[model samples]
Target: MNFALGFKTTMGESGSMEALEKQLICPICLEMFTKPVVILPCQHNLCRKCASDVFQASNPLWQTRGSTTVSTGGRFRCPSCRHEVVLDRHGVFGLQRNLLVENIIDIYKQESKRPLQPKAEQQQLMCEEHEEEKINIYCLTCETPTCSMCKVFGAHKNCEVAPLQTIYNRQKTELGDGIAILVAGNDRVQAVISQMEDVCRTIEVRITEVHLPKAQL
Candidate 1:
């Protein structure tokens, strides 16, 4: 009975992790989302590079169809939903990065590296330089975790350090703000594309109206 329960628990954990990894896969690359993942107006996600490639591939529309819809930029259909995405002069650079997804990927990688250990056998990280001291602070200059002893009287004496929790909080706040700003920027870009498309449609109608009177004669 005990063996069966343990086996089921392990299997459940593995399944959840696999499911999450599947969610992060990029449709264009058929791989996990890389850095600078961007969310389309359609709420679909793609790597920025892959999005740029798709947008570039779509440039032929402007030349072949002479699509006057967007004079300055281009558009592409979303792979997941077939929704169209129009860009500005900045192209993919104007796309909002899905930083939340990126943070999840980073966390997944870090968690994967750590092996599960039984509570009784869990180990503490000790400083290599001060073998007797536990690594309790992070060195800002060297970007390493070190022991208290290192800060006061060791090689890291000249370096600055911070509590690990403080660094974690600061980074979290910064990323949160970035994600919010990017999301807003994305909405505005979409709005601009939509407005340009409308303008093009109106121009086409006016041209047709002028030609219609001549055709009647």
Candidate 2:
């Protein structure tokens, strides 16, 4: 009898932990929510880009009569729960995106405490051609850093090359686009959240109206 009682208690504890895990998990990834957003109808939440990325990655490739290559587009399904979400519904997609963005920003603000370090300080790559110099400039075609001498060589003869700084800036811009996407998603969610608050107020007023009549009776 004692064993049985202990088993039930352990099971109960496990169940509670599972519930907490579900709350933290990303709806899109079915893992911890990286960037969380609340969805409509069910009000279930998910990571913002996770859902959209899943949709884009899995779309149908039905090419009509003449097309040689197939094109895929996003599906309107929640990433975590696999629930069908109607993207066309006014404010729904925007709200979910906003929530995710806000969560990501909050997380970023917390992590920003770690100061940025310079790459050159960390990497110690020496140019093979010029034994004395660090090969910071990269050849585009050869796809390798060359000291001034290697820059004139075989594969890099006509290829375009640039200093590490230029490459860093270009890569940063590309990464910035991804960050911008998250920010945009967050903005949409914020707009809907304001609307949701208004909705809550309306419901409260209606509830009071219903209660007052009963109190009078």
lDDT values for all models: 0.81, 0.59
| Residue-wise C-alpha lDDT for candidate 1, range 1-217, written one tens digit per residue | 5743443354345456677789889999999998999999998999998997888788754332343344467889999999999887667777999987997787666555656544544467899988999888889999988889999999889999998668778889999999999999999999999999999999998888888877574
For candidate 2, the 10 contiguous residues with the lowest summed lDDT are 87-96
Alpha-carbon lDDT of model 2: 0.59
| Deviation from native of the Cα of residue 70 in model 1, angstroms | 12
C-alpha lDDT (0 to 100) for residue 138 of candidate 1 = 86
lDDT of 2 by residue, 90-148 (tens): 22334445454445445434333434445565677787656877777778777766765
TM-score for model 1?
0.44
Best by TM-score: 1
TM-score on alpha carbons, each prediction: 0.44, 0.31
